[model samples]
Target chain A: MKIAVDAAGGDFQPENPVKGAIQAVNENAHISVCLVGPEAPVRKELEGLDYPEDRLTVHDAPEIIGMDESPAQAVKTKTRSSIVVGLGMHQKGMVNGFVSAGNTGALMAASAFILGRLDGIIRPTIATFFPTIKGQGLMIDAGANLEVKPEMLFQFGIMGKIFASDIMGIETPRVGLLNVGEEKEKGSETLKKAHQLLEALPSFVGNIEGRDILAGNADVFVCDGITGNILLKFGESIPEALQTLLFAAMKKNQIDGEQKKLVGGLLKEAFAPFDYQAVGGVPFLGVNGISMVGHGGSSPEAIKNMIVNAARMAEIDINKKIITSIA
Target chain B: MKIAVDAAGGDFQPENPVKGAIQAVNENAHISVCLVGPEAPVRKELEGLDYPEDRLTVHDAPEIIGMDESPAQAVKTKTRSSIVVGLGMHQKGMVNGFVSAGNTGALMAASAFILGRLDGIIRPTIATFFPTIKGQGLMIDAGANLEVKPEMLFQFGIMGKIFASDIMGIETPRVGLLNVGEEKEKGSETLKKAHQLLEALPSFVGNIEGRDILAGNADVFVCDGITGNILLKFGESIPEALQTLLFAAMKKNQIDGEQKKLVGGLLKEAFAPFDYQAVGGVPFLGVNGISMVGHGGSSPEAIKNMIVNAARMAEIDINKKIITSIA
Candidate 1:
């Protein structure tokens, strides 16, 4: 199997991607990587690293799209960009999957433009994976297409369910529609109709409230891109704020001895040692080929995990299943 | 000043409401109480409560709305319920303000129906307090109206700013439109238009990210009812979940003994012990009269706090100020 990595993507680009590709090559001897980026920096990171020469190769690109760059403009203008080159490789079957930590908009645009959307899909969605109270759940369309219809949400649910089963190892994951209230009649008119349609599905768990997401009430949480974006961002920001609050609280205590210890101890226990960035990329499902988009601040470990996740998706032929089911 | 209390509202109902009203009376000798609910149960709870005979009175209402009842349906059927009676008293000038912990939907409906909407206010909104990183802020239409327009959101910002300044004593509270990202152009079409419109406002702080609410980026976070409801519930549920998670972790010795104590201490420090239900219930700002809707989960302390808040609103003539400003 072949996988393409956008070496020029993300904040800690070239270096992290180079290290990640080396790690993926070491773990999966059967897989080959086509690293896309400006050759100089990519080679600089790989200088001291030893790897299986035959399994890793680099595809040089002249320019890179920035995080703040417009997706459409970048995809249109920077045709030689790493994202475009990687997507082009996937389209030509030179690589079965593509991974990037670049501009989310640019990644989405390039994937949709080059790989194209699956047959039954309206617009491809960005599905985010998180460790919930019950375990791991996938939230589809974390922030891809803003204006989504009922049909689009249905496709998201279908894709999310398939992704959960194929990647997360859930045999028949329970799917829940993220809503304000549990009542079927509650939420917007769009949601009410979507709920009715989702209820007919076998593994549908009805409506789950925002509070229930942490409790991990559903294996797959579905929503339109707009609401889904806010929900995903909201979930991601909580641990971040909690950490800041804890540090400030700890700093506020000066004269305390046992009291200080108690405060310090509680702060440590409250936070689980989860390297959120390590869970880096989210899979942009519903595309013709597998595409993983990582965070801009992704570290080497996170990039490595993202590559592993991409390989898992490729091993399970997730793209084929999504196209078959959602199509 | 006269404040009406619904003795039959809240989870604790008659007992808490009676105790709260008695406390309010004891604390503020000048305020009069018109206890509205089932005569027998309310009187039973207030049997031994000693206060000025002239200041204490009871109005009989025999119906109750269950917490689980649908808001619209409850308002339509439970005509003689405590919430309705309390709101009616406020409308009739028999009381300066009304408070209930019965049902949010019913409270909003009854307040809109009895007291009516303020000028230029197309729909009544449930404005409640939010605990910001700096202090507490107010969010309007917390869950009053689900699908909202840009105009409604703009009104919420205007009213929320005035509310924070007049009630909470924040000078020119930084008003922010709660959105998915900080980029001025980063949300739905409605949000885009709202941003454009808000840019014209003198006090608008542009767009605020989900993390900013706790980061203390803005004094007032404004959004539609659905988002506001989700955000509020998210805030309430997260801290509770984290607390539960810590306890479970501590039980298995997943954390050390000292760490357990520290986590517990941090949890306490992180959460404020504010009785939101009794913080004078959710005030239906943009209404003609001063009416507050308390959560059914309210305890006596919550009811007492709500009564105090209501008295402050009445004493300052909040309704008149809001009406004049909006007009």
Candidate 2:
């Protein structure tokens, strides 16, 4: 299967995405990559890399969408950008899927406008992997629709459930609505209506609170994009905040550097399993085609994983499952 | 000023509340407390304590409201419950303030019903202490109003600012609208409107993302109840989650018990300064009277601090400042 990778994406640009695409093709015999970027830089980054020549190729798309540019404006103006061109390839069946670590807003905007929505999809959502104690949990609407209708959330549940089952390998994943309280009639009007609608699914768990996010209470947590985005960002900040507090305490207590190093090492070790970098990218589910967006600071390995995951998503034909489920 | 303590409130019950009132009066000579609960049990618990007899007294309030009871229903039925009776006393000018560690919803309902809202207050908000690296910040609408209008959030910012400046001891606290993005036109329609309204205040800081919460970017973080409630619950869950993950990692690495103990001790010390228990209770800002609610499992020390804080709130007359500012 063919998958297009945005080499002009992420903080590392062509280097990480270029190397990541090469690695994915080298590791997966069935997979071939079309790296979309400025040809000169892409080739220069690929100079020392050894790979299966026939399985990997480059597509020149000189324009770049910056991380700070207006998503809609950037997509409109930068038609030749890698994100635009890569997804265009997928839209026309030139590639089976497209992956990028570029601007999230631009990617989401471009994906919806270019590929259109899958059948029965009200609004496509950004689904993110939540690090939980027991295992990984998937949260949908991770900053797509700001204000969601009840039915929209119900659809998110379906999309999240399919993604979790097909891609993340959690069969019959328990879906929970993220709310203020655990009770059925909790939260805003939108959440209340969403709860009633989500009850149609046998795997639907009742409302889960913020405390449940990392407690492994639900496999798939559904919420409006605002809550999900805030939760995702808040979750990302915990390690740094804890470390700051920990260091202050260590200094005040006059603990020796050796002990501090030991504690620090232990912290890093514990956090390793739940690191965002290791997970690579998250999918903007409910889009017509497979489109994944990784972190801006994604490593080559993470980029590699994103490409492979994109291929796996296409192989499973997740959109068809989502369409059927939501229908 | 006279304050009433809920003897039937909190997990520790009459013991903690009884001793806490004694400690508050003992420590703060200007403050006096009336312990409110079932007369027999409260008086019996208060026996043998060497408190200033004139400064400390017990008031009869026989009915008990369970933590799990429906808040509005419980307030309507359990008229003589401590939360109800204590607020009633404040309403009747018998006490200057009331403090409880009982059901949050029940207290909010009863407080609003009994004491009423301050002049020009749109919706009374429950403002809780946000523990940041710099110090304690206050987040308003912490599960009081589920769906907030733009004007209501603007009022929350004003209430939060007054509470922070008067009670939290910050001068001109930086107030921010908690949102999904930092841009001016970001988030839902309500947030954008709220941002425009908040611009009237000189202390207003534009939209703050989820990452800014723990980093101490703003002293007064204002959002709708759902966001604030979720953020509060999520913050409360972090330490326990971290500990669980840390233990599993330690077991995996086979770290010695002694080192684990040392690391654990350091973690606890660091977390102590930011402990919610240490902060005691948070105020239901915009309420006509001073009303504070502590943690369910509040210690005697926490209860003492809550009572003292409640008295301080009365002394500062924070509601008057809120009314003045919002007007």
Candidate number of the best DockQ: 2
**Candidate 1 lDDT, tens digit per residue, A214-245?**
77789898876666676666666666666666
How many Å off is the CA of B305 in candidate 1?
1.8
- iRMSD in angstroms, per model: 2.5, 0.9
Residue A182 of model 1, lDDT score? 92
In candidate 2, the residue pairs with backbone N, CA or C atoms under 3 Å apart (3 or more residues apart, or in different chains) clash, namely: none
Per-residue alpha-carbon lDDT of model 2 for B1-327, expressed as tens digits? Answer: 899999998888889899889989999999999999999988888878799999999988999998889999999999999999999999999999999988888999999999998999888889999888888899888899989999999999988888888878998799999999999999999999999999999999999998898999999999889988988988888888888887887788788778889888888987775577777998998889999999888888989999888888888877778788888
**Candidate 1 local lDDT, B1-327, one digit each (tens):** 889998887788788888888888888887888899999988888777787768778999899887777777887788898887788878878899988877777777888888888888867788778766677777766877778788778888878887788777898889899877788888889888888877767889998876677667888888878767766776677777777766766776566677667666666665652335535566778888887777777777777777877888888988777777667
TM-score of chain A of each: 0.93, 0.98
Q: Give me candidate 2's TM-score against the actual structure.
A: 0.99
The TM-scores that each candidate's chain B achieves against the reference are 0.92, 0.98
DockQ of 2: 0.84
Model-by-model lDDT, in order?
0.79, 0.90
